[model samples]
Target: MFLKRITLLRENIPSMKKYPFYIPSIQNLEEIDINNKVTFFVGENGSGKSTLLEAIADKCGFNTAGGGRNNFYDVHAAESSLGNYIRLSWLPKVTNGFFLRAESFYHFASHIDTVGAAHAYGGRSLHEQSHGESFLSLFLNRFKGKAIYLLDEPEAALSPARQLTFLKIIHDLASEGDAQFIIATHSPILLGYPNADILSFDDGQISKIDYEMTDHYQITKYFLQQREKFLDELLNDE
Candidate 1:
């Protein structure tokens, strides 16, 4: 399955407006050659990246709590009258995909345990594992080949090393043409996937960017470059 194009129409509802909610208006979205590959969505907090992902998953017919579902809206809908709107012009002509949200892993594990293979988790509940470990185990165990996956902020729970491991897993899936991944992440390591498209959502617009050109990479670079100066300033303060 391939995604051809994706477009957003509206976002960021204002308070005091008749309806104050941040809902996206998306259109003309399509995926191409996505049978086995990865697409990276990069942005800072509150930049509409996760919202777009959730919308896409919803259009793809994944259960709302599963990888493609968006429960964020449910919690915020009462507070914000604005609702999400999406248009998926094209998708993989196949089925069997997931929409995974990093923040909802605990809920996902619980749901999975009830109906799916409870013993596959080695008797260790998702709550028992460290966040990074749990993510790794889930990807390795649950992800089957020939599937499409949408991930929101997967880097949230992963350490840098674990992000690297996630990259390898993605590579393996893509190489086999068994999976396609659309991921929203802040980790430069995960963004380094070769040939993956990096779309940035900032200042109310989205555009393609190079891996090295991302704010995450540049900010991390600056901090590492001036670590000594930063440390000296801190140590000398008082």
Candidate 2:
């Protein structure tokens, strides 16, 4: 694993009293250990999960939109200064890394096409394929492993079946023993990665949780087991 730990330095707390720093989970943040090959960040929107992921990726010098350092495309404004207050510990060697923010991936893909790098992703342009197809193709062809991958809600573009494929692909990457993943997602299937360190950001608190305890898993199980009951409850007018 490239990243060993992440610490939110206390000295930075005073500076978080304003706009960008208003994200509560980041305000109360502590440290997170990167002991496992796969670390999943799960949370509700506005819970600060994406913010933390963005901070980490930005701090580590990965492009804020997506792709490695050399793959530049200026689409987004500068990220929050939160990355400035965070500290990361790493192993001696971190060969390569990529930062992928799901919402911005389309822009990233457009940049790839603009740069005439279709060959990098298996001779097909990302825009030419279905979102899920392109997502899988990216890992299958471009993820040469021995690297760190930071992904934010990659499941946004994946079907359940495709999520499983992504899981398997990531599992295979982890099996190589040199790649590490820090992903923010709401997919139960992705969070089910065995032995992964799952951090939950619910109610503005970041805490470690088991797969079964995740809202994604719990709500999915409830909905599947009693679909009609849930439907009735959800559909019935008060």
**Which prediction has the highest lDDT against the true structure?**
2
lDDT of 1 at 18: 41
Give the distance in Å from residue 12's predicted Cα in candidate 1 to where it truly belongs: 17
State TM-scores per candidate. Answer: 0.77, 0.95
Q: Give the C-alpha lDDT of model 2.
A: 0.85
Global CA lDDT of candidate 1, please? 0.66
Most TM-score-accurate candidate:
2
Candidate 1 residue lDDT tens string, 72-152: 323222221212433454455646677777766677777655555556655567767888888887788767777778888
Off by over 4 Å in 2: 93-95
